[model samples]
Target: MKDTAKHQGLRNQLVKLLAEKGIYDTNVLNAMNAVPRHLFLESGFQDFAYQDTAFPIGAGQTISQPYTVAFQSQLLQVKADDKVLEIGTGSGYQTAVLCKMGAKVFTIERQNELYRKTSVLLPKLGYRPRVVSFGDGYKGLPNDAPFDSIIVTAGAPFVPQPLLAQLKIGGRLVIPVGDEKQVMTLLIRTSETHFEQHEFGDFKFVPMLEDKNR
Candidate 1:
């Protein structure tokens, strides 16, 4: 489906809702407004795309609730030209948001189905990440380490050490860490060997699994 004027209106409404829900980052809100979230969903679900809730995008993964996406993105504090590594590309919706905010995005997806679909869809929508590979999220992207920030869209039982290792000094890694219900956790690499940790309430996400689809 195409991004119509109606879609734009819906997005504006969504952004307004996000702001009301405490997303004060103008960059994040503007990116959220600019990216056509409805386009990332299937045709059948497109109607509900502007809703704040999540919808299944096949492969047992959901396209992340709009609020969750906005919340994580706001926490990231992305700046233009920021090198952001995104774990779990999923629908590529979050990737598009970062891209819209002028970030150089390197994203990983573990599910083959999502990897292929998002790879094609994102570029078609003009949101081309620097690297979009099918891989293990836990490992992050070592070759391109020291990113300005990183975002994990899935729920992890614990923070992946490799992700922490990959952050630049003073860089942020925003992840949802827990079992059934996750606590939104942020780790800022303060120095060569130290990180400051903080938690921002709870959320639910599909598990960040091991390895890629075989």
Candidate 2:
């Protein structure tokens, strides 16, 4: 659970890899570096934490690859203090990065076990998202609608309507949509009734699940 000297060195190398692969947002890069990815993994896999691959975090979820996290984060265009609605809270690693970048995050996880584990673990690690709920991410947090940005950590077969409805005009939503392989998609709420969509190629992710529990 410690952010050891070795972990920081690995993260520094990871920052370089992310940079070579085009994740140029300084905030995103710094946040990626600052968070110790090893602490998010099982002890056995801790050494591989910064190697640019997803590692299982139980409950059928994995801590996302650092590049995917950084890539999506950069696309989010997060501003300090932006109210970010995160649709998945797997391992709380991504949430930690957002928090480090000064986003007030409201994150949801469908599985209660992962929810409880991360809810406890995050605060212990110093991440305090605005809210962390165990529920259907597709529905989002309507009471906290008008978010400045939203990021979905899993692959969705289709874009959920409620999530889109929750964004403030001019807000951004970053999601991956597809079945076998997802196309990283971004939506900008350009008007009260209109949105701008863009796709950024394919990536694999665990399918976004629904329901309050398994």
Candidate 3:
């Protein structure tokens, strides 16, 4: 019961942080609360899980900040049982949030070490999303095409055409875009040939690399 108590405390802290930061969506808050942020961090960093900062998980990658995760998830507007594509699995923290929000997530990781680690950790945490190989996240998951939503955790120079093509009409893609500095962007598929894009202010993220696996 000690673990359960700790989880509850973390959840309360996350809710308080979200409210303080103006994350008003109940769904996003609940998902943030449901997922155990501590599980995604190194053992030594468990105490810092409730803080609003990115923490390293090796392989030069960091688990994204809670606000970033909540903002992306909220922008995607994921519905229960929706199929969502995640570009970078990282430490699987965002993946866990997606799963908790009721998204059927298909995630890809470019770093082999991080991929292997998250693959083992996720199932152990009871929040496994479908894991795929490393490559250009811009390509997205085609076999699972026409997804309900797509989220890219890394910052890209531009929205990849292939990902836009994979979005079902009315589906949304939430990603960070720009070079060096980035801004969170939300793209909505209006029709087979049209899209609407919105910029959601500045954010920093690791550059989205191509073919890190090769």
- Per-residue lDDT over 151-187 for candidate 2, one digit per residue giving the tens place of the 0 to 100 score: 9999999999999999999999999999999999999
Give the higher-lDDT candidate: 1 or 3. 1
In model 1, what is the error at residue 94, expressed in angstroms? 0.2
Task: Give the CA lDDT, 0 to 100, for residue 195 in model 1.
Answer: 94
Clashing pairs in 1: none
Off by over 4 Å in 2: none
Q: All predictions: root-mean-square deviation over Cα?
A: 0.8, 0.8, 1.6
- The lDDT, on a scale of 0 to 1, for candidate 2 is 0.93
Q: Write the per-residue lDDT of candidate 3 for residues 80-101, one digit (tens) a residue.
A: 8999999999999899889988
Q: Name the regions of candidate 3 deviating beyond 4 angstroms.
A: none
Residue 34 error, candidate 2, Å: 0.4
What is candidate 1's lDDT per residue for 15-102, written digit by digit as tens?
9999999999999999998999989998899899999999999999999999999999999999999999999999999999999999
lDDT values for all models: 0.94, 0.93, 0.86
